[model samples]
Target: MATKNVVVDLTKREKLDGTNFDMWHRKIQYLLNEQEVLETLTIVMMRPENGNTAQHRYDLETYESWVKKDHCARFTMLSSMHNDLIGEFENYPNAQEMWNQLKISYGGTSATILRALTLKFEKYVMDSKHSMAEHLRTMSTLIRDLKAASNNLSNEQ
Candidate 1:
């Protein structure tokens, strides 16, 4: 019989902080996928109880161990944020709910945010007085924001 135990190292990373939700989401997502626990975020393993069979005991032990490891990873990443941000997610029992809650609170509906970003980009104009670098920077930033908002435009645009 093999025991499933994970020794997790909670490394602090600013990229996981809520200040930049787009980047933070991507970074944490990549981490979870790489760790092979992305599915655990959405699919919670059931704790088999009331059945003393060997398979039931095995299932319970494995499920609990996996949940703990998954939770540890999620919490460590979230710990990078300020305490106030932490408060918003404390009620979630698993990483998937926490991620979804954060997304809704910070990102809003994709259509709504995209409309705003598109309008902002449309209104942006580079002044002749500004340096070429400054002009490019302004345009590039708006473009990046629009992309993050899930607005895809053809290269011609």
Candidate 2:
């Protein structure tokens, strides 16, 4: 039997370690090295807006070249999803404008995604009524697990 698939929307603000956190932001940053990944991400995310085949090909070529030349050292492959989706096109001086325009061209798909996440978080905050001890406990457990995994990996090596 095929396993059931569960989609998790993790952009909602969640409490952890006694603090409210943007789970999506943390996940994105954890997957990417800020400096090295930004350049490639800028180009990729902006290409759809420009819709120039030549420009798209050029950005891809440049991205390949930079990777080959190790100009992307701070970046890791773990960030590929975001890199492929939107980060790569963010380098242009007017990339924000490009994205905003793309957002319109795409029938507000991006805006819808943002709105969904925002609504989920807002509802969660309201439902929780600001109690966060359970969230803190959950975070502590996650941290402990991560530390244990790291230690195990080091020992294995």
Candidate 3:
């Protein structure tokens, strides 16, 4: 099991004596430098607790370890992609619109996989971040979009 522990210097968030924003930024820079070293390894898994819960599977703790070691850019990348997934959901005004979009974008098992990925992303953001309730609300909105999309697909079929 290849595992890495991470240390974060959140001086800006830390209530320490003489700690300023500049110090915090500098500390973040150092953290980024360290993270660059870690990304050298292959990302065998994105999330620890994935769709499968087999004997060979690892938990979210494994994924979080990487997240902790990840640089600011990496964190931002995850955030941006998550937002994009939701945005894609929201782009459709109604179920009909969603069905049309999904029809063009995916087919068969691929469609199922794509929807599952979007839903999983919602779960991932809600689980990993501190503000659970708020994230849940966001997930709720996503769920509505997903449901609407499904309805549209059914109507078309």
Computed on alpha carbons, the lDDT of every model, listed in order, comes to: 0.66, 0.36, 0.41
How does candidate 2 score on lDDT? 0.36
Best by lDDT: 1
Model 1 misplaced stretches (Cα beyond 4 Å): 1-19, 109-143, 150-157
Q: How close is candidate 3 to the true structure, as a TM-score?
A: 0.22
Candidate 2: which stretches are off by over 4 Å? 1-38, 41-65, 69-111, 125-157
TM-scores for all predictions? 0.59, 0.23, 0.22
Consecutive 10-residue window with the lowest summed lDDT within model 3: 15-24
- Which runs in model 3 stand beyond 4 Å of their true positions? 1-103, 106-110, 113-125, 151-157
What is the C-alpha lDDT profile of model 1 across 92-149, one tens digit per residue? 8777777777887766435656676677778878898999999998788667766766
Tell me the tens digit of each residue's lDDT in model 2 across 3-109.
Answer: 11110222222212111123333443443333334444344332234445997778877656655423332222212223244444344244234334433433222
Residue 33, model 3, lDDT: 57
Candidate 1 TM-score versus the reference: 0.59
